[model samples]
Target: MSGTFSALNAATTALWAQRRALDVAGQNIANVNTEGYSRQRADMQAIGGSAVPAFYSTSDGIGGGVSVEQVTRIRDAFLEGRGHTEHANYARLSTEAGALEQVETAFREPGDQGIQSLLADVWDGWEAVTNGPDTDATRAQVLQQMEALVGGLHFASASLKAQWNQTRENLTVLVDDVNAAAASIADLNQAIQRGNQTSLPVNSLVDQRDLLVMKLADQAGASVRHGKDGMVDVIVGGVTLVGGTSATKLAVAGSLDLAGTGTSPVRVVTAVGGHTVRPDGTAAGQLAAMNGIFPSYQSDLDALAKDFADAVNGVHTTGAYDKLGNPGIDVFESADGSPINASNIRVAFDDPALIAASGLPGAANTDSSKADEIAQLRSKAGGPDATYRRLVVQLGVEAAVANRGVQIQQVITTQIDASRESVAGVNLDEEMTNMLSYQHAYAAAGRLVSTIDEMLDVLINRTGRVGL
Candidate 1:
C-alpha cells in the first residue's frame, strides 16, 4: 500500500517539476530579443533519491521525481572586459576624427575658390601694377586688390577661431555625461557587491552595471577589475576612481578662453568618498580634443597672422612716394583688435602741394615703387596659402587613419558580442523544443495517475463480484 502511494506522490512531483522546466523555457524564448537580458535556465536534480527504499537491500532504488536545484544566467566575465576595452579605443579615434573635420572646414583647400585661388588673383593684380607703373588709377586698383586680400584673411582667421571655440564648448557639455555614467556605474557596483555578500542573486543590477561600464568606456578609456567578492573597480589614466562599493567623484573645469590661453586651464579632479584622489589622463575623447586640437589650431592661426603681416609690412616700409611712407609704422592689427605698431607714422612730403595733393603714399601711391611693393605683398599672401594647404593635407591623413581605427574596433566588438550571444543568449527555436518535451512528460505523469485509479476500481468491485 505504501509503495502504491509513493508512486502517486512521485508522479505528482514529476508533473510539477516538468511544469517548472517549461516555464523557464518560456521565459527564455520571450526574452530572446531583449537587450541586456542574459538567458535563464533551471537546474534539475532527483527528489527523495537518498530516502528511496532499496530493493532487496541492494544499492539500487526506485528513482523519485525531479527537483529544480537552482536557476542561473550564462555569462562570461572575460568577454565583457574585452568589449569595454575596444569601446574606449573607438571613442578616442572618434574624437580625433571630429577635430580633423573641423580643421578641414576652416581651410577648405581645393574648393572652387579657396585661399589658393584668392592668392593667385592677388599675384595677377601685382603683375599688372608692375608692368604699368605711373597710372594713378592702376595704383588705386592695386589698393583695392590689397583690401580684397585683407578681407579674405580676416574671414578665414575669424572662422577658424569660431570652430576652435565651439570645440571647447562641446567638451564642457560631454564631461557632464561622463561623470553621470561613472556615478551610475559606481552605485550599481555597490548594490551588486551587497547582494553578493548576502548570498542573494544580483542579476539585474549586474546587467545594469555592465551596460553603464560599456557607456563609460565609450566616453573615455578605463581599466576595469573584479574583486574577489564580485565587486567592480575602475581606474583611468593611472587614477583610481571606483573601488568595490565606494566611488570617487569626478569634476571637470572648462575654462579655455577664446584666445586659446586659458583664463583658467581645464582640469579634472577626482575624490573618493571625501578624500581627494589624483587626477590623470581621465579626460579622453572630445574633452581631449578641446584640450589638445583646438588650442593647436589657434596657435597655428596666430603664427600665420604674424607671418603674413610681417611679410607685407616689411616690403611696404622700404619705399616712399611723393608723400612720406616710412618704415616701422602701423600696417596690420592683431586679432584682439589691437593696432600692430603705434606712434611711428608721419607724412614725409616737404612741399605742401605734394602733401595736400597726394594725401598718402600707401593711400594709393601711383609711383613705380608702389608696384614693386604690391608684388612683395603678393609673395606674403602666397606663403600663408602654402602653409595652410600643407595643414589641410595633414588633416586629411589624420582623418583617414582615425576613421580606419574606429571601423576596425567597431567590427571586432560586434563580432565578439555575437559570439557571446551564441554562448549565453537565448534561442526561441531551442526553447520551443524544450516546451514540447516538458508538455509530453507532464501528460505521461497524468496518465500514470489515471492508470492507478483504474486499477484501484477493478480490485475493489470487479474481483469481489466474481467471488459472489
Candidate 2:
C-alpha cells in the first residue's frame, strides 16, 4: 500500500514538472518577437529517494520524481559586450562622415557658383582692364568681379561657422539624452537589485537596462560594467555616470561663439564630480569636427584670403594712381590693418576711378602693365586657388576614410549582434518543438497518475470483496 501511494505521489510530481516546462515554452513563444527578450528555459532535476523505515522499504529504492529546479534566461555576456563596442565604433564613424559630407557641400567645388570659379572671373576682369584700362567700363567690370569674389569668400566662411554652431546644438541635445538614459539605467538597476534580493526572476528588468546602456554608448561612447546583485555601472571617458542606483548627469561647457577667430574647445563634464568626459560615440565625432576639422578649414581659408589680399595690394599700391593722382591706396584693407581673412574681407575701393591700371602714375589712364601683373597672379604655383584645391582634396580624403570606417564597423557589429541573438533571442520554431515535447511528457505523467489511482482502487475495493 505504501509503495502504491509513493508511485501515485511521484507521478503527480512528474505531471507538475512537465506542466511547468510547457509553461516556460509557451512564454518563450509568446515573447519571440519582443525586443531584447532572452529566451528562458525550465531546469528540471530528479528527486532522490525519500527516507523510509526498514519495515516499510519495498524493492531496492523508489525515486521520488522530477521537480523543477529553476528557470534561467540564455545569454552570452561576451558577445553582448563586443556588440556594444562595435556599435560605438560604427556610430562614431557615421557621424564624422555625415558632418564632412555637409562641409563638402558647402564648398561647392568644381562648380560655377564656388569660390574657385569666382576667383577665375576676377582674374578675367583684370585681363579685361589690361585690354582697355582707361575705359570706365573695364574698371567697372573689375570692381564688380572683385566684389563677387569677396562675397563668395564671406559666404564660405559663414557656412562653416553655421555648421559649427549646429554641431554645438547637437552636442547639447546629446548630453541631455545621455543623462536621461543613465538615469533610466540607474532606476532599472535598483529594481533588479531588489528583485535579486527576493530571489525573483529579473530578466525583463535586466534586458531593459542593457538596452538603455547600449543607447548611452551610442550617444556618448559610454562603457559599462556589471556588479553583484544585478547592478550595472556606466562610465564615460573613465568617469562613472551611473553606479548602482545612483546616476550622474552630464553638462556641456564651452563658448559656442562662432564670431571669434580662435578655436573654443568644448567640454563635457559630469554634474556631480565635474570630471571631463572625452566621449567615444557620435558626440565624440561631432566634437572632433567642430573643434578640429572645421576650424582647420576656416583657418586655411583665412590664410588664403590674407595672402591673396597682400599679393594684389602689393602690386596695385606700387603701380598706378587713383583719379586724384595719389598712389593707389591698398586694394584690400580691413577697417583696421589687422590681417585680412574670409569673414572680414571686402572691396576696399568703392569707386571704379580708384583702380590702379598702370605702373606709372602719369600713365594710369593708358598703361596696362599693373593690370597685367595682377592678372598673371592666377597662374602662381602656391596661390589661393592651389591652396583651396588642396583643402578640397584633404576634405574628400577624410570623408572617404570615415565612410570606410563606418562600413567596416557596421559589418562587425552586425556579425556580433547575430551571435548574441543566437544565444539569447527566442526562436518560435524551437519553442514550438519544446512545447510539443513538454506536452507529451505531461500526458504520459497524467496517464501514470491515472493508472496508479486505478491500482489503488483495485486494492481498496476489489481485494476485500471475497463473496463477489
The whole-model C-alpha lDDT of candidate 2 against the native structure comes to 0.84
Residue 1, model 1, lDDT? 51
Candidate 2 clashing pairs, residues 3+ apart or interchain: none
Candidate 2, residue 49: lDDT: 81
**lDDT (tens digit, per residue) of candidate 1 on 1-468:** 556666787888888888888888887888777787787777778865455446664322566667777667778778777766776766677777777777667655667445566556656665665666444454455455545555655666666667757765665555567667777887887777778788787776877776777766666566688886667788765666667766666665546564534555555555333332223222465555566666666566556556655665555444434333323233444534553221111122223212111213554344455445545554454575566666567667877887887788779878877877776788878888888998998999999989877877787768889966
Off by over 4 Å in 1: 51-60, 131-161, 190-201, 228-230, 258-265, 271-283, 320-330, 335-382, 448-468
Check candidate 1 and list the clashing pairs.
Answer: none
Q: 191-295, model 2: which lDDT tens digit per residue?
A: 999999999989889888888888877887777788999898988878888998998888987667654425447778877666788888888888777777788
In every candidate, how many clashes are there? 0, 0
Q: How high is each candidate's TM-score?
A: 0.78, 0.92
